[model samples]
Target: MATDDSVHPEARGLEVVIRTAPMPADANGNGDIFGGWILSHMDIAAGVLAAKRAQGRVATVAIDAMTFLKPVYIGDLLSIYGEVVGVGRTSIKVRLETWVERQRRRDGSLTARQSMRVTEGTFVMVAIDEEGRPRVVPEA
Candidate 1:
């Protein structure tokens, strides 16, 4: 999985599910963006896709094969991209990838930036009924 994640560049053509930058409060003791923050965004991205596919409410069932490939900094512009990789009776498996564009210098300019993948994960989202029970995933 590391090889697959490392070989790919920024996810182009795939849907840009969420795009935002980290703040100082989002950083960890090491000065890097906290892993949980990235994981939450990935879940949100996957949920967006999953809900659309299910055409209704959905819940996160599991997060599989989560990988942190690189560190995200406070100023980096984070982009979370998602793709629906699989669908079942009530579950949708989404592949989520996060990339960060870092400012090249202290000038805080976007003109010169570096983009790299920092995290990738597969989130399993399940279509749910109003009662919170698993429901059939509708056909697209």
Candidate 2:
């Protein structure tokens, strides 16, 4: 059975996730949104929080528990949200959740309310110094 929890939206404690529409350039020959595109968005969301916490530059060291629940099509609006799940000496784990919204029919009879949940990945980012070496994260 396919597990929906892989990209469960409620997993990440996000107040407001940003929404963006997928363009033709983002899709593959089959017209499905490329996984890389979604991952990049998640990284961007995570980076925003990571930079705020590190107070400097940060690099992605690892991604944990990533799974693609459904294929995304062009014109679909994507939403991604992230939360700082864990913090180490120099690393922070950000849990990200992604969702998609598609347009309904002209009659507004509920065309598609599908929640793909693209993936839930824990991004490990390390704080970096001016020289790019890992530095201790500041206390919250």
Candidate 3:
């Protein structure tokens, strides 16, 4: 067997944690959804899942480089899914994938929702106690 480098090679599976729509308020000056908005939602999704796995409170410690495959726009139904790629003593690494079902208007009529990959990222969350100290993750 070969040693695994930085990121783990295996992923348990992905589950949809959040489904939301980007509003006009979330749009950036370019008229597209702001990357920060999407990132914030992804972090929330990660925290929800991490807290459940940790059986308590958790905090986001790190995020790997993010790559946006497509742009997100208003009226798009965004779906955020996460998978547990790795679990350490006090940390749970989650991989988040964002897909969007976009609504496009053509000739003054709304088109069918088309789903496409928008962006993805990896977040490192640590289980914490009431005092905000790192704690061990409970076995599932």
Candidate 4:
């Protein structure tokens, strides 16, 4: 995938955990993608990393911080990148960023795609067992 050179320095080298484009159904009446949709995607990406690190099931317990840097429009390819920033006995913290490669009409023609950072958040996930109770996170 093509990347923008202007992305945050800290966002560099993070693993791209999820990449998907939003459909019209994912947008609000104002034609912008819903915040919940983006948040859900972030959560899913965090869960994937957390599960891998935990070596088992994991559940999102909290979103410690989330900032919407820009609006997401339909047809923009959203890519979520994540990394395991912290780990505890039973919880893990994942830092995630969502970037969008956008296509827009310019001068009645499609402009060259440009990538931009849209949202970022830190997700807190807890390792879980088969019964859905918190469990110790295995050592990596």
Among all candidates shown, the one with the greatest lDDT: 4
Per-residue lDDT tens digits for candidate 3, residues 7-125, read: 22223246889999988899987668999999999999999888888999999999975778788887888988887778999999888888887778522258876777688888999
Question: Which residue runs of candidate 3 sit more than 4 Å off their true CA positions?
Answer: 1-13, 105-109
Locate the minimum summed-lDDT window of 10 residues in model 4.
1-10
Worst 10 residues of 3 by lDDT: 1-10
Please give, for residues 19-57, the per-residue lDDT of candidate 4 as tens digits: 999998998887889999999999999999999999999
| Global Cα RMSD, each model | 2.9, 4.0, 6.0, 3.8
- By TM-score, rank the candidates, best first: 4, 1, 3, 2
State every prediction's TM-score relative to the real structure.
Answer: 0.87, 0.82, 0.85, 0.90
Better of 1 and 3 by TM-score: 1
Q: What shift in Å separates residue 130 of candidate 2 from its native position after superposition?
A: 1.2
What clash pairs does model 4 have? Answer: none
Candidate 1 local lDDT, 45-71, one digit each (tens): 999999999999999999988999888
Instruction: Report model 2's TM-score to 2 decimal places.
Output: 0.82
Segments in model 4 whose C-alpha atoms lie over 4 Å from true places: 1-5, 8-11, 105-109
Clashes of 2: 0
Give lDDT for model 3: 0.82
The lDDT-based order of candidates, best leading, equals: 4, 1, 3, 2
RMSD of candidate 2 to the truth, in angstroms, is: 4.0
